[model samples]
Target chain A: MRILVCVKRVPAPGAKINITADGRAVDTAHLGFTTSPHEECAVEEAVQIAEAHGGEVTVLTLGPAEAEEQLRYAASVGAHSLVLVPIEEVDWDPQRTAAALTATISGIEAAEGAFDLLLFGNESADAGGFQVGVRVAHALGRPIVNGIKGIDVGDGSVTARREIDGGFEVYEVPTPAVLGVKEGINLPRYPTMKGRLASKKAALVTIEQSTEAGGQLRERLHRPVEQVSETVILGEGPEAAAAVVDVLEELGVLA
Target chain B: MTMLVLCDHDRGTLADASLEALTFGRDLAAAAGVSCEAVVIGKGAEGAVGQLAAYGAAVVHLASHDVLTDFGPEAWGETLAQLVASCGASVVTACGTDRGNEVLAQLAARLDEPFVANCREVDPSGDTWSLTRVQWGGSLLEDATLTADHKIVSVAHHVVEAAPASEPAAGTVAAFSPDLDASLARTVVTDRVVLSRGITLSTAPVVVGGGRGVGSAEAFAPLEELAAELGGVVGCSRAVTNNGWRPHSDQVGQTGTRIAPQVYIASGISGAIQHWVGAMASKHILAINTDREANIVTRADWAVIADLHKVIPAITEEIRRRRG
Candidate 1:
């Protein structure tokens, strides 16, 4: 029941996001870094799965050396192992990221036995390309499903649930499969004092990998014009209640 | 040198997002000095060919197979990959819906090409095409470039309005069947569990959303009643779902359903960034919160500074009173 969870470090944006002067990237000077929200859930899911199944959970990430913070965060949450695929560049397109991950995963699987499951965030918080997980799964020759919210381990099979408009769709994929898990799958746990201490001593494995950039290149970033609308205060409390109903009626919702 | 638009449908009816994709593809193709064709896959896809042409598909390619009865990412990706080669398409595009993005991802994997998702604008003017895509839903935007010989992209949902040509094209319909292996079925949809019958959060014209101030699971009754009175559905924030006061399907946020309701009545919700991304797409937002400085109140089109418990019932009563 060994598992691997992949995560990405992204800027923790506040109420307003500011872009860099050149418009090439987020202005991170004032912002701190944290694991993507979905991947935080991914790490939590992996740890819980390992705890219940009596196995180990390994957390992997491909980013700058600073990504070690994210890996340590995973370790603080009961992950047994950590691997960092350090990239020198500020960003790698989805294709190169997937290729590097595929090669690293192959090497790990060859050394250690194949992990029963591999988990990735449905999409990265920054790029949101929605391709790396699928590409990596294809390269590794494993079945993959995206936008999964629930997972249950069965006899040599993993049942994943994905939510749609009015319902949910389920898939029963065999072990050694891949899943792109979204947030809300589970509420990630905070790091405890003991867990934080252990994380400091946890062994960090760094893999040096280089690959060609993909066809897509980032030219620059530009913020869309803000649509400013002045809020009209109809009334206070139940006094303004009539105005609210009038607005709803005007919108034709109160039919 | 043809641009290929992948049409998405629910077996019988075409998705509005796909028509939007066709509209986007038509413009991109014209800019690239080529024709815009469409590819429809899976069951009941043939029935959508004419409708696609009405939206300006120059040629419609239908790929139907027994195994393609349900949505399988691998199979659809493989089919699109084959179509890209057969049609000699210079660019492939789809709506950035869950299925659309997933299928294009699979195609990118098979062909080892770059695929961009949630793009609001694309300029295929020169060798390096500039793209503006949404990140963190629509809270932030990224301007990037695509330097691929064969570009694959999925337009962000609802970014462009779906428009029909002044004169519908008499597009030709062609059939296609790719050589799909049995292994691709491993991740196919096996079963479906429908929780609600109708008026889902995404499709509901009006949505009544609750938050932490709503208190408990039982407290949602007022919100539900308000939604029912408005002929809409009830939605909630991630905090409400995290508190177990509402189901995940009813949650509105970045990780939850991205809704575009005509008006979203958000009560007691201090809007967080995650929740803002999902609710921002709504045409109009009315926030009811005790805190005037709350994010939802500050950003909403209309605000009522009051306790939702009293204001909700009064609004419902007002609507009922006026009708009587």
Candidate 2:
């Protein structure tokens, strides 16, 4: 089984963010960048699938030069190879991003043999667009079972459990497919220093871009506007309860 | 006549977000001076054809194959590609919801068309789209233009309230049985279960979600109770799933689920971008986080700096007492 995990580098979602001075996009001055939260889970899923199935796991991405940091991170996570679509920057929207990714995946399929399993985070944690994996599947005209919470693959097929409305939907799909994993699909392991060191020799492949129709990448992104509301603590202990009661009573609830 | 909208359905029930997308589609179609029709897939949706027509669909194309019951992105893309080619749509529309977005993304790539997902609106210009979309977890809004022959846009969820046309036409229902090679496809649907009564997270007017800060799965009782009282669904954070407190299905985030409720009440969770992406399309966001400056507070319409342990119980009690 050769597994391909699509990974993205996004501003560390845990960091504070603001739009840049141009009001075009998120301010990166105080931000730290890392493997997108869900993509990290994808990388983990890929490596685990490889470990379990006895095959190689390759990491694929599209980004600027500094994005190589993510390839090293993928190595630490146990990826066997890295394919980076070299670009100063890539499209911001899911549509164009999907195109870039589809191009990269096609290039890989042409070089390496067809991938057995393709994994991605349910969606990029920051971009928040759950379009790529399915788009890639569509682009390649391959089967895709997505938003999988539990997966069982053996023999010649893939079985997965996904959450539906109130309960779970269990599915079975053949191999040579795509699976978009949500968090809790599996807990990702922290990269060990040894793994990181060994990852130094992993391969990174880059590709040039074709003209994209949408100029969705030009505009900057910013944080949502802050909304304000008034807050007043009631008081302490018994008095607080009394005041709270009075307030509730005044609102015609406890009266 | 000019647009084809792919309606996302499971079995027979239309995805609620699709209705919201229909609102955008109708508006976009009107702007383009073209009529819009829909292609409905999946089984068990016998009654949905009427609703699709009610939502301004001129015709409802139904393809009720057994394999179509389960969502295979490849087969779906193939189906929609054929639909577009045969139907002669200049544009294809779907909701930015997961399934619709996925199918359209694939369709666009297959057709070599440009698309933008989660676009708030699209101003159609001849053969292009001037689009606006939310970025960085609803922290930013930006505008762009797509120059493509086929302008496909995934309308943002819950951004536009759904209002069907008055005096809906009894849309002509056509049997669309496309050829699909099941052997070549990878996934098959085995079983499915739907929530019994609670409002769907994607379609709910109100959502009450608990995070790890809520402490335990046992803690969800009050939140669930309140969500019920509010006529909403109970949602969980990624931690809730990781801790084995809740199934991963209820986790809301990038890896979890994307939802657009009218009113969202988040309890005890630090608003990580992953978490925020799930429910930020809400009309109103009320965050009750212990941290006064939690990221959720910044994005919320109303922020309450209090422990959910205290607030959830008190609020539930108030609801119970008031019901009396």
Candidate 3:
């Protein structure tokens, strides 16, 4: 029941995202870095599954060397091992990233035994390409599904639940499957002091690799034009309540 | 060379989002001087051909395999991949729904091509299509280039309105049977569970959205009361969900649910770009916050500079009084 989870280091953006002067990447000077929210939950889910099933959870990340911090964070929260595929660039297109991961995973599997399951965030919070997991799974010749919330492991198979409009759709894939986990799958645990100390002493594994840029190439990044609205102040505090009602009535939401 | 659009449907009814894809495909095809076609896969796909025609699909490919009776990413992607090859499609597009992105991603992976999701604009004037796509939800835009033999892209949802063509196309229906192996059904939907039934946050006409200022889970009571009075629902920001004050299901943000209610009552929310992308689609927005300079207040159509604890309850009482 070995599980591998992939996480990406992204800037924890504030109210606005400031692009670099070159317009190619996000300005990180004023921002702090953290793994995407959904990936946090994915790491938590993997650790929980391994804890229950008597296996080890290996956390993998593909980013700059600083991403080792994210891998260590995963270790602090119960991951048994860490793997970092370090890259020099700010980001790679989905295809290139998936290719690098597929090759690295194959090499890892050849060295050790194959993992039973591979987990990824539904999409990276910043790029939101929504395809890396699917691409990697296909390249590795495994069954995969995205937007999964609940996962139940069983003998030789795993049952997953994907949220939809009304309820959820269920899918059961065999061992050696891939799943793109969404947030809310679990509330990730906070790192304890003991866990932090252990994580600091844990061994760090780094894989250096680079792949040719894929077809999708970034030209620049820019902000979308903001919709300027002249807000009409109805009133102040509780006194404005009647004015709000009038506006709602005018909008026809109320009679 | 043809532009192939994948139309999504629920049972026999066509999804509104697919209409947007159709519109985008039609325009791109016209610009490229190529035929625009559509593919609707799964059961009841025939039901959408007429509407697809009205939206300017020159040919509607009805694809069905024994394994495609239900939604499966691999099966559907295989179907689309076969269609792309058979139709000689130069570009493939779909609405950026969960299923749309998933199926097309599978197709891209099978073909080993680059697929861009949530694209606002794509220029096919050159050998490589230049694209402006939504990143970080709709808050930031990325200018990119897609160089592939067959470009695959998904139009961003809610970015464009679905409209019918002034003059409809022939919309000739062609039955398609893709070669699918039984193994593709491994990821097919095995069953379904209906958790709760009713208006959801995305479909609600009125959404009372609360943020960190809501204080606690119990503090959402005033917002709930206000929403119930207006026959709406209560929504929360990612901050609230992160704080464990509300479930992620109730969150209105890029990572949560992208809501397009008629009127959104956002309270105690600073309106970060991530949250704004989800709420910006609302027809009207009213911000209730103590900070006059909050991002949500400045962007909202109307603002009530006050605490939501006082404003929300008062708004509810006023509605009750008027009804009486």
Best by DockQ: 3
Any residue pairs clashing in model 3, and if so which? none
Error of 1 at B198 (Å): 1.1
Best by lDDT: 3
Error of 1 at A220 (Å): 2.4
* Candidate 3 chain B, poorest ten consecutive residues by summed lDDT: B8-17
Residue ranges of candidate 1 with Cα displaced over 4 Å: none
Ranking by DockQ: 3, 1, 2
| DockQ-derived CAPRI band for the predicted complex in model 1 | medium
lDDT of 2 by residue, B98-182 (tens): 6777778677767866667778768886654677776654555667677777777787766788888776856788788777776
lDDT of 3 by residue, A1-255 (tens): 788999999998878999999999989899999999889999999989988988989888999999989998999999988989988889988999999898888888999989999999999999999999999999999999999999999899999999887688999998899999998788899999999989987777888767777899999999998878899998788999999999999999994
Task: List TM-scores for all candidates, in order.
Answer: 0.96, 0.84, 0.98
Backbone clash numbers for all candidates listed: 0, 17, 0
Native contact fraction (fnat) of model 2: 0.45
lDDT for A247 in candidate 3 is 95
Model 1 lDDT at residue B299? 88
Docking quality band of candidate 2, CAPRI definitions: acceptable
